[model samples]
Target chain A: MPPFSRFTALTEQLPASVPFVGPEVQERQAGTPFMARLGANESGFGPAPSVIAAITEASATVWRYGDSESFDLCSALARRLDLPCEQIIVGEGIDSLLGLTVRLVVETGTPVVTSLGAYPTFNYHVTGYGGRLVTVPYRDDREDLEALRDAVLREDAPLVYLANPDNPMGSWHSADAVTAFARSLPDTTLLVLDEAYGEFAPDGVLPPVSDLAQLPNVLRYRTFSKAHGLAGLRVGYVFGTAETVARFHRVRNHFGVNRLGQVAARAALEDAHWLDHVRAQVAAALQRLAQIAEQNDLQPLPSATNFLAIDCGSAVRARSILEGLNAHRVFIRMPGVAPLDRCIRVSAGPASELDAFEKALPTVLAGLT
Target chain B: MPPFSRFTALTEQLPASVPFVGPEVQERQAGTPFMARLGANESGFGPAPSVIAAITEASATVWRYGDSESFDLCSALARRLDLPCEQIIVGEGIDSLLGLTVRLVVETGTPVVTSLGAYPTFNYHVTGYGGRLVTVPYRDDREDLEALRDAVLREDAPLVYLANPDNPMGSWHSADAVTAFARSLPDTTLLVLDEAYGEFAPDGVLPPVSDLAQLPNVLRYRTFSKAHGLAGLRVGYVFGTAETVARFHRVRNHFGVNRLGQVAARAALEDAHWLDHVRAQVAAALQRLAQIAEQNDLQPLPSATNFLAIDCGSAVRARSILEGLNAHRVFIRMPGVAPLDRCIRVSAGPASELDAFEKALPTVLAGLT
Candidate 1:
């Protein structure tokens, strides 16, 4: 049958495309689970034991809808960040929040600025809302802040996105640089400063929470998926000025965040020692990943996040290596655009999974050669 | 600081109103937990033991993202419903799906039709997308199907929402009647046939899945939240023609459904015996609720779903009874619009919770008198 005839013109014009093809899809196609699942930047380290307990405990109460307000989680987040509860709004994940943010600011033909080949989910939301994308190419495997600012100004873009400790290439800027770039933006331009990888970055890599909390146009997004190791639970939040964050309530799915996510995230927050252990594991895994890339004659890019991007020297080589790894039952991803596409990204995970990737990489590279 | 300057004019114009204040929020304000939690229509019997076990088992893997495709869950649903897997799309919840549906069809000033006291979340989503709502009031305590059809025809609305075994009043239309109403609408008017409470509804209250699965403009929304007792898990799905269902891919949060939710929902769907058990419990609880209302000299409406709406003779009496119930630590709700406001709605729950309500009702009623 023909598709529904009444979908909006924008929806009709849009192509059906997912931002990411999950590793499970590949597993189904291959008819076997990957021996090492590392794709999509999910932490193989998993969540804290306390978080697991919380989720298991919460299992009995799954009949109750999650507090639509996400009250406790937001309050705990506020306390940790030294911000008022009004400054924080918890959501299903950074992806869901990004969708809401785009919906709030984007209208048909509205211009939105972002780095080319950045987080595709942000771009998906922008295009989903019929916003015209203004792309700024990365410079030296890092998002070019100056160029992004230029594009935002040139297009008179009302919305802009920047991910610190960036995805795919795993590149980052100093906190001061991010602060300067954020401060440089016109008040009219709202900045979605995604800090999904902030927990893994060096101390100096993230500005103090208070530094940008007062900025009405800056909403800093963070997730438990990375260092906190709860990707499957889908908990994330954005914090900004009370006035700006409150606007999320005007459009957000109030009960979108699952009950266990709130429970798991709150437990994850309380377990600081577990977070520290995960960070240590991620740091060690990054080194092992770098060594593996070097052993395979690939250049591993410097990373601030819990993943390493190995420069396979060319887009063709990167694609071949990625497919070769997949064929060897090691799941990994790569950047989708030029320049950055020369690299394949591997998320930090447990030693056994990393060992599988380590054991398979040389053979996969040799097969490609 | 002022709110972000880039929020669209529509977003700025919208108020920060949630469809319902969760019991948790009310508990916070009241400084104590409700003795009976029945306000939100969530199942109090809880999910099946197998589902709980699945959640606990899946708790260890909360670091991995849920399969973006929701492959296994969709396949299971398709198998059970005798539909192609491509015809179903699993999402965070019915609420989130409603938001996406509105976004897909409602552009600025687009007309959408629904009953006056229907699901507020749908209205919130429609208004969030700048859709002009054309509401037809309920007739005789049930959604006036004829009036709804007339409104759709009169407004030339692209979208119409009707929840079978509907919320608030817990009234239902026969499957044949619903099928006829759906067939009568213009193919251009997409019908969001919400069957959130379908499992609790009597047999033949829902058309066979195959009957409307072939219709491009008729999307059937079902959830694990109601009878399956997994509201906290936030899993729901929509099924229609493959072509129309595929459109969800263009805008859905690919990994929005949490991993444990996927696990729990799949488990819940498999446990038919558990569903039957819950239905029996709900049936008994509904009768008990009706007895309590009648004992208090209030009239209880006939219901096919898992709730009873007690008519307190007038809107003022209903409001007073609802407030008295709140003061007595018995959580229940009433419809928001006039006429419907004369009814106080109570969900079917465990005997302990209902016993608490049963004990408190007379006292609350006497206090009100």
Candidate 2:
């Protein structure tokens, strides 16, 4: 049968691909569930008991749709961050928010800037909105802020994605460096500062939330997916200047967020002690990951976030190591392109899951050669 | 402190708005929850017990992101529909899917077609994507198939939305008419057949799934929101020719659909008895609603779906009745556009709530007069 022919040329030209083929897909293709799932940067500690209790309690009230304004959650977030509620807008996840921001700024051929090997989902949104992507390669495994700023200025790009305590590599710059980069960007450029992993990052890595509050050009993105451990719940929030944040209402799927997500996220926010505990756990896990890399004669890159990127020397070797880990029922992944692809990225999970990875790594490396 | 200034002109021109302000927002503004939530077409009877059970069961694994592929749910949905898994794609809800479809088909100045008072969410998506909506007014309170076809042919609209057992009016075309409408459209005109309320529609109102299976131009939309009572779960699916469905992956938020939504929807699918019971309840509720309308000296339009649209003589009277009902703590909604706005829409819920409506209708109308 012939396909529907009405899609614009840009959509037709795009490949049928996802930013990441999930680890669950990997398990399915392997025809067995992985014994250790450390590919996705998920907290294996699970949500705090309070969050689960909240979810279970909210289950009876699931007949009602979530608050379209997400007022309570926004108020909580704003209070914690010292911003007014008007500056905060909640959505399904930062990924959905990224897509909305891209849509707002992009028309056909509009230039969008990001790192060469940064988050593919951000790149996907840029292309999905028919924007021209201008990417600068990572300088020393960190998103080269100077190059990105230059590209934005040179191309007059209206959108830029910056992940602090970044994904894949899990590397970061200091708060001052990030603030400087933001201040340097043109007012026309809308910086999507994704802090999905911010809760897991070292304290000093994330600039103070109030630092960017008045800048309409900066949208700081965060999620319950990482440290809060509710990725499956699909809740995230974006906030900045009220003027810019208000624009999200124009295009957001108002009732798109599930009821449980709202319940789980609100509860997660209320449990800051759990956040601290999870942060400590993730820090310990990262240390364990670094030790494992060293024992296996691999170099583990420094990460402010939950995941560790261990350089396996070459992309070919990294691929084999990833496959070997999988063969041993340890699921992990790596970046897609170039120098970054030379390292395998593993998320911090439970101790037993990390033990499985530690045990499997040496054997996987032995089999690799 | 200056704001970002580079949004597309169309986006800048659009108002910051939600298609429908959720009842939760209404409750916040009113400082009290509605006693009856019959406004949003949500199933107050609630999701199957088994579905909530699935949610509580899946709570542990929610720390991880959902399957970007949404494999298991899509496979189950495909099997139920007898389509290849490749031909089925799921999203946060039909709202999100509509946004992606609009992105695929619409550019600035792109002509899209739909009924004058159709699903506001679809129109929101079209406007968000800068599509010029060419609306064909409803005929006899049902979506006008002949006029929509004429509009599509005249403007060569690339995308058209048609919801069966449609919202607000709760009216439908017979399967023969629906099929004829589909068959009448040019292959180039993509049909977004929203069957969000299909589960409650008369059997003959829904075409055999196979009838449109080979028509690449047809994409049938279904949701767990209506009869299944999983609206709060944000699970909706669309199925079409494999080739047409493939395009969603090119632009969709792969992990946008929540894990609980997947689990709940699957469980909802499996609970055939609950669905059957709900449909039966809906049929009875429709009758009760009609009786209430007749008792109130209003005309309840013939309905194929779970809601009743009671014509109150004129638009102003309908608005007054709606406001009066809400003032009495009974939440109900009406279509926003003319001819359609001449009626008030009431969703099917447990009769105890409808009893509140039954009792309040007279008092509300007495004051309206």
Candidate 3:
């Protein structure tokens, strides 16, 4: 069982861990399936009918490997984003893209800046690359843009990560503020703008794709996992200047993106009507979740993403609810680190699942009382 | 459009080129679809009905990211391979796994060894991670095992790559020779045994999975992309000592493997009947292709793979016939270097597609004349 003694020093020093425990893993551990599967911020509404049809059609052609270049999908994305095709690089997900971006700049002991408990996946990549993490605490439950900018300059870091309409907290900075924050970063630093949930963000929360396209240091990523509801497909893309995205081609698995993902993503993009409908449904679900929180004397933070961070008043209380829900077969996740962990994160689910959450919360909390 | 000036020197120097050009790209350039889609070594026979059923049923679950741990798929694979679940780590593909392996061991200017014109993706990853490639030419259409071992020792390489049932030329070394190669390497040097087409190789051509499992220095890769007819799903897994597989955890995109791929691979593993059928078909097609090569006054090399490389007397003649096939809407590929490029490589397809090849080869050759 001895490991090859020759792995890079950084890899040997790292511990085996994952950024998030998948709901499936929870089900296996709990030995019971969740009554409500809203933990991972995946759209329970599912992909459009058209997307399903496309997938079924592609199932026959699954023998041929997907285009390593991701040509058609990138072309489609470029047209949609109003950027040239050269500016885009498709990947397995924003998670993979983050790892690639980190590898491009981070080396042993390299300083990388991000909010303390933002996207654990980004931090995982930084640590994987042997980069020292410099974290700025969240301010007012939002990624503190001013502090992040300061940290980048103070550390003279080469990499900075921010997620707009952020995960876990589901709070966001305005597009104008993000633009200013990106502009403020040193030219030596690469800014990774993770907008995995941009399709569900409120108006003015996402800047125009062109807004950051020309910045050599900025890489903005988006995914079909959110409103498009094809998360199981694992297709997301990053776009910036041709030179910026071109670097991805050098290190990327040209065939990394799967064929099912490519077909589903293309179909999802063409299903504009379905996107609008899903967005409306997500908005409604957010409202319903907020109402459920209000009824329970819990504070639901403002959300511009598919999930809401419900304030349970303290981290201990939030932990209790999370454990209780899992015991009750209601799978949910919270932010890993405090103070973000004080708020239990719940994703928008269909009415049936939300109803299960509504029915279970009071009883679980009452038993605690 | 300039890229950032601060990229790692390795990233800056790596070329924008990729390993494989997708058949779709070739079709686009050909301005016509192929009559016989026999390139890239895909199974035109397609997957089993049960596998497609699995994919369709899994569509409703596409909203969730695949299990980051990929436990179920790994367990299924372990059972299939008679290994423990801990021994297998599924990845986006063999291509992606190779990249991770390189990242684990390779630093700038780290020496790496492979056959000249071996799998380009492996070379890409080595160059990507700043590993210097030392290539040994094939001997009598087979990877020169002695030269590879000598290079590994002389260059003090930490990593080496070998593909059984090699691509660009469908050649294979005996399983005994392969085991000897793995045993001959230094314990500090890791051997990436790429067995992508192992299923097509004769029984004695691939070493047993357990043969090299005890060698912490050895990792074997297998994929559903070829004989199993799931290439587009992008599922490839590597099995090594638990120690080496553990290193993948330090950097793998846990959710990088898509949901459908996980399900399809699990389903394919369950369908032993389909695998047997495809193997027989591939063998017969190789026979048919050989006969056609003789009809064209070319020598077809003995193949342990789904494709055959016919010696067309010269590299120029091979290129002319390959180009003529494309002009005839009969898609095929050839090796890139001399000796190998003197042969045209063709994959097996369904009867009708093979019939297209049977009909078109003579006319295309006549047109060349």
Model 1 spans with C-alpha error above 4 angstroms: none
Ordered list by TM-score, greatest first:
1, 2, 3
| Alpha-carbon RMSD of each model | 1.0, 1.3, 1.6
Candidate 2, TM-score vs. the true structure? 0.98
Fnat of each candidate: 0.93, 0.85, 0.87
lDDT of 1 by residue, A1-369 (tens): 689998888999998898888989988988998999888788888898988988888889989999988999989998899999999999989999999899899888999999999999999999998899999999998999999999989998999999998987889999999999999999999999999999999989998888888889899999998888889889999999999999999988877889999999999999999989999999999999999888878899999999999999999999998899899899999999998999999989899999999998888877876
For each candidate, how many residue pairs have backbone atoms clashing (under 3 Å)? 0, 0, 1
Which candidate has the top score in lDDT? 1
lDDT of 1: 0.91
lDDT of 2 at A234: 89
Expressed as tens digits, the lDDT of each residue in A8-102 for candidate 2 is 98898988877888888888788899999898888888999999988888886676777887778888888898899988899999888888888
lDDT per residue for candidate 1 within B1-369, as digits (tens), equals 788887899999999988888889999999999999988888999899999999988899989999999899999999999998999999999998998899889988999999999999999999988999999999898899999999999999999999998887989999999999999999999999999999988889999987887889999999989888888889999999999989899999998899999999999989999989999999999999999888889899999899999999999888988899899899999999988999999999999999988888888788876
Q: DockQ for model 3?
A: 0.78
For residue B250, give model 3's deviation from the true position in Å: 1.3
Second chain TM-score per prediction?
A: 0.99, 0.98, 0.97
- Residue A147 accuracy (lDDT) in model 1: 98
Pairs with steric clashes in candidate 1: none
Candidate 2 lDDT score at position B313: 92
Model 3 residue A239 CA deviation (Å) reads: 1.5
